[model samples]
Each structure stands twice: as structure tokens, then as C-alpha cells.
Target chain A: MIQNVTLVGAGNVAWHLGAALEDAGLVVDVVYSRNYSNAKALAERLYDAVPTDSLDFSESKSELFILMVSDNVVQQVAEEMTLPSSGAIVVHTSGAVPLEALANAGLYVGVFYPLQTFSKGKKVDFSKISICIDSKSERILDMLAEMAYKLSKKVYHLNSEERRKLHVAAVFACNFTNHMMTIAQEVMESNGMHFEMLEPLVRETVDKAFAIGPDKSQTGPAIRGDSKTIGKHLEELDGKARYQEIYKLVSESIAGIEKE
Target chain B: MIQNVTLVGAGNVAWHLGAALEDAGLVVDVVYSRNYSNAKALAERLYDAVPTDSLDFSESKSELFILMVSDNVVQQVAEEMTLPSSGAIVVHTSGAVPLEALANAGLYVGVFYPLQTFSKGKKVDFSKISICIDSKSERILDMLAEMAYKLSKKVYHLNSEERRKLHVAAVFACNFTNHMMTIAQEVMESNGMHFEMLEPLVRETVDKAFAIGPDKSQTGPAIRGDSKTIGKHLEELDGKARYQEIYKLVSESIAGIEKE
Candidate 1:
């Protein structure tokens, strides 16, 4: 059981994870951040968890420490923290960084990555999020697995390499998809059309991808090699050079998929 | 009132439109298609609607004729169908085709494009989808608008030029987004990871794009010029050479956005 937990960040992931842990009946022992106010705000919602701005190595006192800081800060934060005991486990919620970074501290370290992008001021459904866990020791891995299973139905014992691969996949799926949507919104708005018009299609595309997976569910003019429609779309570009290029590139890519 | 409607072809669009219209208390008087079973199945969904397989010009007989056939078949469907009445309104549900194709038949012609990607066996929330309407006559346009408003909250009186532009935008927002998701799924499954793991991130990326728009919300290794991680990711790519190239291209594009 994850009885007491310490959260070492106050970003979107930290806020949601802190609240989720508390809701799961775990005691969030303390919340720490360089920005004391951010720590306090998250702590206030975490069932009496104490909030502090202190980075003192002397304060490492929880059974589980969750580092929810940015990817760039994960290593520095890990280096500065002092564990209360070698028995305590330190984990960072980052997709990139190796598990070995925690080894030099001579503590039981692992990763507790929530495979989700969190936004501030929005509630997260942890049940839908996958938790990727990896630890230096079997005993620590077991404890992390137990905690992850409590929060999510899907849990994976991924090493640094696998996690890094997954992160790259996430870039393609999440980041690229969002950019595509943004381009679509820009195109619609430029035509005096409302962006909301694409909302149903957007929602459906995601739902369908989840339902049948993406391979079989894919359909469009590009996949069909309907060059007439593609040509018309390109002509409709009317001097918007970059967007037209994107349209051509993506369509050609989809066409290539069809060829295979 | 769009009391009497004639469906000129039995297909995905026709089936959906007939059902929605019947549910909204309109009369689908006749459905004509080369495939009798399809026409019959659609007509059966409507109250007392007749299904006809006639291609003869003498059989024309309805207030509104909707040709919901394929893009290539639409023009042919329109050319063969004689208007039941000289003043009867004719419309087609196509994003790319001009409303003018429904002309030359000596009837009031227009377009009634429900701006959504339709799939058989999938139930859609029509109320949220936008309907694009255009007619040769203002009275016909008003009637189309009212019918559209009955089914949805959004109704746009887009001319052929504007509707063509919207179609091009749809290719980006709907079609291209789907392709990106397909690639993401491919990358994950080709690895040891399950496609389900990427769902949360996919949903969040979309939510964030809408919240801040893509241009400002973009954040990835590429945008940050974190070439170290990018190189690591490239090294991690197992056998998906196409995906790696896509990753490189998109990353460069994101870097360009950051520079701008």
C-alpha cells in the first residue's frame, strides 16, 4: 500500500497526481517546489500534506517520492534530493531520461511515468491513463506496480529504452496530431468558417482510432489516390504556400501507405 | 416545409439523411437507386416512403430530390433523373462537387453537405455537425436552411467556391489527422507497446491544441531543438524507416514554427 507519498513538483502532472493519490486514500506526506506558492496550492488539496519550498537534502522522508518536474529538471532534482533512508523509493514521472540517473544517489530509484499529457485546471481520468514503472530492485518494482495498478488498469514494466521509444511514439501521436488539427483550424478560419465545425470529425477520428485501431479505420481521398480531389485542394491553396505543401506531403504519404 | 423528399441514390449519405428527416417528421416520398435493396432498406426507415429503381425521365415526382451517391456517380445520377416537377428543388450531398451539376435538369438546384466523414454502422450526433447549404434560389436556400437547422445548430450558406474551400480544410483537419494517428499506432504496435497506451496522450494533445491553439501549444523535442533526444529516438527506431523520416520531417517543421 502507498501509505505516504511526497510530490516534488507543482506542474500539471504533479497537481493531478497529488490529487489522485489523495483520492486513492494515500497520504501525501509533503509537497515541495522551488515556488512555495505552487507547492502550497497542490498540498492544500492533498489531504493535509505539508507544503515547502525547501530543497534541503535532509527532508527526504517519504516512502515514495514522485518527481513531476519537467524533463530538463529531472536529473538536477534527483541529484539534489537526499533520501531519508535507502529503503525509500524515488521515482520521476518523465518519459525520456534513463533509470541509471538515480543510481549514483545510492537509493532505490525507478520511473513512475503516467502515459498521459495533463493540463492544468482540468481533471484527469487516471483509469484511462497507462502507468509505466521500472525500478532498480524487484522489491521496489513490486511496490510501484501495486501503486500503479491501483490507479490504472494498464501497467508496464518498461526500461529506459522502451520508455524512450514510447515517448517518441507519443510525439507522433499527440504532438503531431494536435499540430494537424491546428492547421485545419487555421484553414477553416481563413475561409470564414468556424473551427467548431470540425469538432465532430475530430472527436470521431479519435474514437474510431481507439475502436478499430488506426490501420483498418483509416480512410480519405489520399488513401484512395483521388488525385482529382487532391489537385483541387492544392489549387484551392491560392498562394498559401506552406499549408499547400503540407497538404501535398501528407497526401503523398497516405498514398504511399496505400501502395503498400 | 421540406415535407416531400426524394432520394436519388441509396448510399451512406442517403440512408443517414432519410432517417434523420423521417425522425424530424418530414416525408421521404421516394428513393431511387440502381441497387434496389439499398434503396429499399433506406426507404423502409422512412414512414410510407416509396423506393423506385426507375432511371426513366417520366418517373420524376417529388418536391425535393437528394442525390447522395458517389462523387463520380453524382453527376450521372443528376443527369438521368428527371424532375417530378419543373420547379422541384434538387440537391446533392458532396463536399467537392459543385451545386451546378444538379442544374440543367430544369429544376431548382443546390447543395446540402453535412460536413462530416460518414461511415456505415456508425451512429453520428447530427446536432453537433455543421450543414453547408447553397441553392440557386433564395427561397430554396431558406427551406434548406430551416431543414438544416432542424437537424443541427450550425448551418452555413456557402457557395460552391466556399464549400470547395471547406472541403480542402476538412482534408487537413479530418483526413490528415487520421493518417497521423495511424502512423502513431503503427509505430507503437511494431514496438512491444500496446496502442491503448497512447490514447490519453492523443486525447490530451487534441484538448490542448483546442485550448491554446497549435501554434502556441506546440512543445516537443523538435520545437525545443533537443537534438540529443531526437538522435536517441532515431537510434531507437527499430525497422520503421518511414516513421523515422516522418519524425525527422515533422520535427524540422516544428523547429521552423518555433523560429517563426
Candidate 2:
């Protein structure tokens, strides 16, 4: 029933999702962006899609409008927009934000969060990414579910509270883990080793998580109660106070797990 | 040249590495273990391989003997065994042990640290795992390099000091990251939510690391300096003092990265 869809941002998520929706035989009405070049770039990749400015959508011809803007600006963008009516489904692709922001504007609101990281140049396979959906109305929810299921194999109807909880887990699992990798890369790069050398280990760590639960799959000197190695590493860390502190904290945590 | 390789441990690393070597056309000669069943279990997987408690190996029998025992016993095992000759390669699959332990035995000594977390009941793919090799002699080093390359796509010829440094990074990247995951799972599980729900987020976190360098790829309320969300997560964590401390410490680290 999703006849026409309008995209209101031109960032990484928008670029990927627009292509996916179009590829699935959905009619993409118009794609808008404050940055004309970004919008045009995404629009050029989609069939029968036109790059347009905000003024072009004044008529609100589409049945659904997806605002793939930054999380901080989602509310502001919703407030600044004029919509067709209170019936059209409006959704934002932010993992953290609730659908209430769109509801306050008297428009049918929902969330269409694709649970994966997006990089501008990287090709994302939507089939593998999980999609989290939420909406105020059951009808809109059904529509969103259909659209989401077409793109991803896994779709969850997470309430705002549950979605927020998932978002927090996401921060720990995805964002913080990546920061740890960054620290590893920095440590190696400072010693004249390429960051690419860590890629195999990084991939293997993730692969292990999928195979065995993280708790049982955990391994290192910290778990083995080998303080000799831990002390040596702390000394090697030297002046990097943050890295040393992290090593201490994580080692202590690993030691606790072993104790339990 | 690694026609017959002897594995001197029956743990997970030894089990997986021995299997990989056999699969790669290298004949695994003998699997020696203190626990007879563990050795037999691993040896059963390889053709023409036998498990034994035999500590004595006649000189010039096997070309390479992989000491995959626990770190604490590696030195003892090296001292107790009779290696082939100075030309025979003696390698221990430990990240922390010094190569001189085997060198003191009047044979070629090296380290074959497979940079991965191995767990029983789960199969591993050696094609992607990184093997860090260290040796005192060039001939032994070349042979180890050839074997490592045959088993894995990535093999690094690092000295003992550099291998030790990389091991420290592995602790941060793999073991520490897995602990963080356990924390995330604990937080959700205690709140009457299933840990399975966090799987999508966990997968995305690792996939994101592969896409961009972890530092630049990181995104969260902490990185964005949104104290409101961080405070909310702390409140949600409640009486879990350790998780709260970790959440705070990691958030501060993310914020510090932004400041840098």
C-alpha cells in the first residue's frame, strides 16, 4: 500500500534506503536536501527520482515522508515542515528518537530505524541489516512493517521504551567497541604498524561473538589471572593514561568474570 | 616442509590449529596432553594421528613441535621434552611467553600466537585468523611463515617485543570488548529483556568497525556529549556499581576522544 515515498534527507541512511525502496518497486516521489549536490547525487542513483528543495514538496503529494536527518535536527525539521494532512505517514530513521516528535506536528508518525552503521562510500546490503519499526497507529505500523520486511529479513516492532533500551545496548555493543578498535589502531599506528593488521583480529572477535556467547568466548591474560603479562602491558602503555586506565578496568572486569 | 607437526597441548587453540594444519595437507604427527581424553578427542579428527602422554621425542623425528599448552606449563614442557636438533623448529602458541624458553633447550624456538579467542564446541575458520610469528633463526622463521601463510591469509613476522605489544592490543580489542558485551547483556537481562534482542546491535557494532577506522566510526550519546542520555543510562543501571562505573568511564573516554 506504500504507493509513493518522499525522502527528506540526503545523508548516508537516506542514500542507501532510497535506493533500496526504489529497487523493491516502490514509487519514490522526490528526494530533498538542504545540500543540493548531496540530494542530486542520491537522486541520480535512483530510477525516476528527482532531486528537489523543500519548496518542491509544498503540495505533500506522497503517502509517506521519511526524514533521514541527523538526530538533533529531527524535531526542528518536523516543526519547520508543512505536511499534506494529519493522515500521511511520517517517519524518521533515527535509532534513539521516539515517534512522538512527528505526532506533535499532527501527522501520522513512526520510526523506520535500520539497525546498522552507514558509511557514505560503503555498499550496505539491506538484506542483512535488522529493521526496527514503531508507529502510533496499527494501520501505519502494518504499512511500515511491509516496507521494512521487503528490505530486511529481521524486523522488530519495538516500542519507544524498548527501542531506547536497544539504542543504549547499541552504544555499548557498536559504538564503544569501535572506539576500542580505534584505541588499538592508534596504539599500533604510533608504533609504526598499519591499522590494517588489526582487521583480521577484529573480524575474528566479531565472528566468535556470533558463534559462542561473548561470556564464554572471552580469552586473554586477564581471564587467566596472568598479572605478569597485564603488568607488562600496563608498563608498555607508558604515558597513555586513558589506555592504561582502560586496561586496568577491563582486566579487573575480566578477573571478576573469571571469579564468578 | 612441515610434513609432520606435533601438537603438545589439547586445549581449544591446539585443537583448532591442529585441525587446520591437517586440513591444509600437513600431517599432524602426535597430540600430547596431560589429559588423555582431550588429546584423543583432537587426534581423532586427523588421519594417521595418535594421542599420547609421551614426553620424549627422538632427535630429528618431527620437523616442528607446537607447544600449545597453557602459559604456566609452557616453560616446564619445553624444559622436560627432548627436541630434535638446533635445526628443528620449536614453537609455543602463547602471546606472552618469551622465545628463549625453548632456545634454552638448545633447539630453534619461536612463538606462534594465533590472534583469536577460541572456545570449545565451536568451530573456527583459520582462513581469516591472524597468526603472529616470532623466531630467533631465519630458517625456522621462514618455515613458520610458510606454515602460517598456508593456514591463514594474514601472517605477521613480529619479534618477541612487537608480538607482546600486539597481544596487549588484542586484550583491549577482543577480551575487553567481549566483557563490555557481557555488561550490556547483563543490563538488559536484569530488566526483564532478552539478551537475544541485542544481537542485531552487536553485529552492527563489529560490521561498522570493518567499514571505517573505529575512532571516526564511533557514535553515541557519549561521543555527542549528551549528558542527559548518559545520566539516564546510569539511573537505569541502578545498583550495578561495576556496570555504572564502566558506563561512566567509557563515556568519559569517548568524550575525551572528541576533545582530542
Candidate 3:
């Protein structure tokens, strides 16, 4: 059983995860960041956590170390960290980085990736989030699973490759979908239409996608092969080159899928 | 006041709209479809509705005619329909087609576009749907708005150009977003991952998009300009040429937006 955790970043993920861990009665010993003020701000919220900008974990005694840093610095931070040679499990809260990224940091290494978008000041209901975990050993896996279950109702034992694949899928589902919305908002704004008008349509679209499978739920001029409507829409987007390219490509893709 | 409605299609939209009109205590005198059985099915559910596959309205007495057909056939259907040449108002339930498409058919022409996706078996609450109405004159617009208000709480008086622009925006917000969900589901299914795992993430993504504006809520390696992670994801999509192109283009677009 992991009683205490050392949080290794103070960004969005860490801010939420640290709070969740504390809520689950887990002790957070230290909150570290490259910037001391960030670490201090997060550390003050915990029950008993020291804030520091140091890589030296010599004074910090914790069973679990969660490196919630950016993907690029995860390896560098893991390499620079000093932890006990035994009995300490080092994990990174990254969807992209594999467990091997933290292999050299501790005796037991794993991933404790929470699959949800985190934003500062926005409260995340951890119970709704899926926590994907992987470890090098069965014992470590079970330990991480137990820890994860405290924070989330959905827990999965996903290996590096499976988690990475899930991450890429997430980018399409969340990131790309959000970008499409951005473009939609831009289209509405450019035409002097209020963005709120699209809300009902947006909600219904997603509800339909989930109700019927997206492939079957697909509806539009592209799927219907209404060239006239598609042509008019293209003309509507006359000078917006980037949007035009996207519209043409995505419509072609939808048509291709419909044919299949 | 328009008390009687002649519904000129028996598809998803017509099915929902017919029921809503009847619920509002407006009489639905007829339900027409190219297929007799479809018309019969919908007509059976309404009070005193005549199911016919004919364009002849000489036998039918109704104050309003709603041509809820496909966009491509909307104009064609309107041209073929025979309605009262003076008092009866004509409208098409389409976001794309302009009012002119129905002008020559009836003395008073307009649009009664319910901006929400409808499925035959699924019940739609009209109150939540935004009904976009437009007409050639204020009197006609007011008439359409009154009828629309009986069904939906949200109603807008959009001109042809504004409605067309809204329709294009809907394509991005609804159709394109659905396509993104399709791609994400495909990726998950291809990797032996159950698509249900994405449901929470999908719901949260949309919630976040609405909570904060889509542009501000954008989160991903692409928006962060993390090329290393982007390159890694591209490597993961290796042989899927279409998906790779989409990932590249969308990521580039996101990066470009982030820079601004």
C-alpha cells in the first residue's frame, strides 16, 4: 500500500492529481517544480508537503514518486532525480511516455496516466476519469491499480504500446474535435451569427454519434453525395484557403468511408 | 394564426416536427412521402392526418405546407407540389436551401429549419431545438415564428444568407466533429480497445469546449508545439496515409492557431 507520494510537477495535471491523492488520504510529502513559486503554491494546499525546486529527493521520504512534468522534460527530470535505491516506485503521469522513461529512477517503475484533459481552476471529477496504469511487475501493477482505484472508478492495465495508441486516439477524439469546433465558431463569427446558435446542433451531433455508431450516424452532404450543396458550401468558403482544404479533404474522406 | 399544417415528408425531421405540431394543438392534415408506407407510418401516429405519396394538394385543406424533404429534392418537390395559391404559406425544413427555392410554389414562402439532428426511433424534445425561421416579409416571418415558438423555445429570424452561413458552420460543428469521433472510434477499435472507454473523455472534451471557448480550451501536443510527440504519433500512424494527412494538417492548424 502506498501511503505517501512525491509530486514532481505543479502544472495542470499535478495540481489536480495532488489534490485527488490528498483527498484519498494519501500523504503528499513534497511538491517539486523547476520554479519554486509554483511548487510552493501547490504545496500549501496539501496537508503536509514541502515545496522545492530541487531534484534532490534525499530529504523527501515517499513510497511513490509521480513525475507529472511535460513529455519533453520527463526523461531529463527522471535522469536527474535522486531517490532511494530500493522500495521506491517512480511513475510518470504521461500518456505518451512509456514506463521505460522512468526505468533508471527507481527499483519499481510504472505509469499512472489519467486519461482526461486538465485545466487550472477547473475542478475535475476524478471518479469519471479513466486511470491507465502499467508496471514492470505484477506486485507493482496491483499496487498502482489499488492506488488508481481510489481516485477513479475506471482503471485499466494498459501496456506502453496500448496506452500510446489510446493517447493518439484521444488526440483525435478530444483535440481534433475541439479544433473543429474552433473552426465552426470562426465560421459563425465571420458570418455575424452568434456562436450560441450552434450549441443545440453541437450537443445533438455528439449525442447521435454516441447513440448510433459514428459510421452509421454520419449525416451531411458529403455522406449523402449532394454535390450541389457541397459546391455551394465550397463557394461560401471562397477565400479561406486553409478551411477550404480541410472541408474538401474531410468531405472526400467522408465520401470514401460512405462508399465502404 | 396557422392552425393546420401539411407535412410534406415522412423522414426523421418530418416525423419529429409533425408530432410536435400536433402536441402544440395545431392540426396536421396530411403527411406525404415519396414512399407510401413511410407516409402511412407517420400519419398513423397523428390525429386525422391523411397519408399520401401524391403532390396534389387539391383534396387537402391546410394553412401551412412544410416540405421536409432532402435538400437536393426540396426545390424539386416544391416545384411539383400544388397548394392553395393565396392564403397557404410554404416552407422547407432545410438549413442549406434558400427561401427562393419555395417562392414560386406558394404565395408566401419561408424556411422553418430545426437546427438539430433527428433519428426516426429516437424521440426529440422540440423545446431544446433551435428553430431557425426566415421569410420574404415580416408578416410571413411573424407567422412562421409563432408556429415555430409553439414547438421550440429557441427561435431565430435568420435571412437566407445568414441561414446558409449557419448551415456551413453546422457542417463544421456537427458533421465534421462527428467525423472526428468516427476516426477516433476506428482507431480504438483497430487497436482492440473498446470504444466505450472514449465516452467519458468525449463527453468531457465537449463540456470543456463549452465551459471555456474552444480556442481557449484547446489542449494537445500540437497546440503546445510539441513536435516530438507529434512526430511520435505520426510514426504510430505509419501506414494510414489518410489519417496521417489529417493528423498532420489538423496539428499544423492547431499550432498555427496557438501561435496567434
Candidate 4:
């Protein structure tokens, strides 16, 4: 039952968490960022939030401070932040940084990482998003779990080591996967074909991968041992050396795994 | 109205397309495959479908013949099958093959490539699937359109070249993308982590990709220009030379694209 909150940073993560927290019955009283206009822009969206560029929270009444800054700046901002008057539970929404990064910043420090890709102006369904929370203190962990359970049904209590692994895995599963799609889009658009034509196929790929395990759900020439189709594809990508390299490496990797 | 369909090659494509066509009120009368058991297994699910290992269709009263064989065998089977008594429209469900492959085999020939992956046991929703149709004759194209439109709202009349481009793009988008997920799954599972933990992140990645274009939706350490995080990931993957190569290459490619 955290009543008031202070959200740090005005980027995609901050904007999303600020709105979701407010909608979930918590009051986001202050929005802070180094840039004044950005702080004002995000703060304006909340019910009665005040905007400030200063890091001082000495006069604020917010019981929870969420640091939604970039991974590089999380530790710096947490150390520079002037703790609130209320012995507030300060947390960062980063999957990479450990909870010890905020050890000296506040009495009760924790990590509340929302496992979703947030782009500004895009509406995210918080209910479907998973939240990974961690804290050293039992009392803070219980509080973190309660606040997280309000936003999503999926909440995992992962430690620093586990969270880092999760982050690395995400780098492969989500970030790398999206890059593959981007490469496909660039290739198709350059060849005078509509990239959207592959929409149904892309959706079906993801649906199948999750419906069955990725190992069982794999399709295409690489797995089927059809080198003819693979040869045609490689020939097509020959002009683009980078795409050709990726295609060759990944295809050979797939064929290699099948042999095992 | 294409009333009766004589489905050839009772594989994954035939198992799905046959049931979908039957459910759309078209009758599937005969299913032929090199293997009699596979034909029987699929044909038994349809209404009044006769399973046979022979390729002859001279005695069958079918109006449409669909070849659902592999890409390598599609053209060969198209040339080998005996023409049915009713002079049916012969089509192959292959993205790689051209419509002219069936030119000497039947009076009416076309392509009815359903643009989705299919497994024998998995249930597929045909309405969401896209069907790509092509034919030299307007009459055959119209008949193909009539039947395709009944099963799905998305029906594209892409020529052979465009269809080939589509197949190539699918290799990058669907096939390669799923492989990325598979790699991530292997990495996670080998490390004593549950692969399903990445489900929410994967779903969100796809949702964001299609909602906005993939270029704008791309988010990660590489895209964010966070080389330190990328370095950490590479270090984690250093033991697996193949994975390390993939990580370094894809990340460098993403960084290169951003510079461009």
C-alpha cells in the first residue's frame, strides 16, 4: 500500500512506469529529470504531480522513489539523489544493475525491473508484462512484491546473478530477434516489395515458437536439409556481404546442431 | 466454386490445408502420398476422403488438385500425376516453385501457397493466415481467388518472382528470427534457467515490431550505443565460439546500420 511515489528520468521507461503506477492506485507526486521540460511533460500527465529538474527530494512526501534512468546513469543518479523525508524505499527499474548499486542511496534499496520493451507514445498493457523484483531485506521484498503484484500477475524474485542472466538472455531473445526482422525489412523494402506482406508470417513464427518449444517448432531449409533452397538464399544475399555472412553462419549452425 | 479438392502429398501442409478447405465447405475427395500411412492418417480426418499411394486421378470426380509436397518434389510430382477425368485446376502449395511447373500436366494450373507454418498436430486458424495465389489464366486465377477468399481475408495475387522474393524475406524474418529464439532458449536452458521465462519479453518484442516499424521499435544495448553492455554479453558468450560469433556479428551489424 505505497501511497505516494517519485519517478526519476523522463524517458520511455519512466513515462511508462509513471503512468502505470498512477493508474494502479499509487500517487506519483513528483517527476524529476535533469532536463526541466522533460520533467514537466511527464509530470503533467499524472493527477497532481510536480515537475523539477533538481535531484533533491528532501521536501517531498513520496514514500517510493523509482529510478528509471539509463543503465549507465543509474548508479550516479542514485548516489546524487537527496533522499526523501520519509524513509522511502528507493528502487531502480534496471535488469542489469545490481541492488548494491543503490546500497548507500537509501535505507531500503531494491530492484523492480519490468520485463517489457517500452517506446514513448506506445501504449503498453501492464497486466501482461512481467516484473522481476529483488531486495536484500525481507520487509522491502514483501513491499516490492505487493506493489508488483498489483501491476502484473507474473513476478519473479531473482537475485543479481539471475537478473544479469535474464538480461543477457533478453539480449538474444528479444533484441537480437528484432534485429533479424529489421534486416529482413531492409532487404525487402530495398527490393521494391512491401515489408508488411510478411506480417502474417512473422506473427505465425512467434506463435509457433511459444506454442511448442523453439527446438520442436523450427522450420525452413536449414532444418529440412534442403541445401538447394539454402543455396538460392545465399546467392540472393551475395551482394550484401553482411547479410550473406549472417545467413551462412546461422544456416551452418542450424545444420550443425541437427547433426548432433 | 471449387467443390472437390484432390489433395496430393499428405504432409503438414496437406493436413492443415485439407482440413481448412473442408471446413470452408469445399469437399476433399482424395489424398495421395508416396507413403500410404501418412495419406491415411490425414485423409481419415476429412469427410469422405480416400487415401491412396498411387498418383493416378483418372477415375476421381475432383475439380481441384493441390500438390502439397516438398519444394524439391513439387515440380516432379506435377509432371508425373495423371490428369483427372474432370480437367481439374492443378495447383501446388509451394512458395519456391513457379505456376508453369504444372503446364503440361493439366489444362488449368495455378499456385495456392498458404503463407504460414503448419505442423500435423497443431491447430491453425485459417482466417488469420494469408494465401498467395498466382496463375497465367484469368479464369484459373478467379477460381483460385474464390476458394482462397473463402478460407482467408488476406489473398495476394503475387507473380512467381514476387512470390520468390516473399519466400526469401520469410527466411530472414520468420525462419531466422525463430532460430534466434532457439539459440536464446539453448543458452538459457543449458544454464539451469527455464526457457518459458522469456515468453513475455518475446511476445512484447513482436507486438512492438508490428505496431511500429521494426527500425523504430528496435531497442537494445547495441542500438542504444551501449558498448559496455554489449561487451559484457560477448564475455558471457565467449565460451561458445558459434554463439560468440553470432553475437559479435549481429551487434556490429546493428551498430553499423545505426551509423548509416
Q: State, as a TM-score between 0 and 1, how close model 4 is to the true structure.
A: 0.95
Overall local distance difference test of candidate 3 = 0.89
Clashes by residue pair, model 2: A174-B205
Per-residue lDDT of candidate 2, residues A1-260 (tens digit): 88789898988788889988987889788888988888898888888778886734557678888999877788888777777753577799887787786766545789999887776666777887778899878998999999998998788888887777777777777777877787887877777776777776766766676566677778888888988888999998999898888888888987897797
Instruction: Order candidates by DockQ, high to low.
Output: 3, 4, 2, 1
Pairs with steric clashes in candidate 3: none
What DockQ values do the models have? 0.56, 0.57, 0.79, 0.71
Estimate every model's Cα lDDT from 0 to 1.
Answer: 0.80, 0.80, 0.89, 0.87
Ranking by TM-score: 3, 4, 2, 1
Residue by residue across B92-158, what tens digits does model 3's lDDT show?
Answer: 9899999898867867888999998777666788888999999878998998999889888899999
CA lDDT, candidate 1, residue A74: 81
A best-first ranking of the candidates according to their lDDT comes to 3, 4, 2, 1
Mark the 10 consecutive residues where model 1 chain B has the least summed lDDT.
B55-64
**lDDT digits (tens) for residues B1-260 of candidate 2:** 67888899988888889888988999888889988898898889888778988777764367888999877788899888877654567789987777877766555778888887787777788888888898877888888989899989789888877777777777778888877777767666655666666666666666666667777677777887878778877876678777778788888988998898
Tell me which of candidates 1 and 3 scores higher on lDDT: 3
Winner by TM-score: 3
Error of 1 at B108 (Å): 1.0
Score residue A57 of candidate 2 by CA lDDT: 56
**Residue ranges of candidate 3 with Cα displaced over 4 Å:** none
- Give the poorly placed runs of model 2, Cα more than 4 Å off: A30-58, B48-50, B58-60, B84-87, B187-208
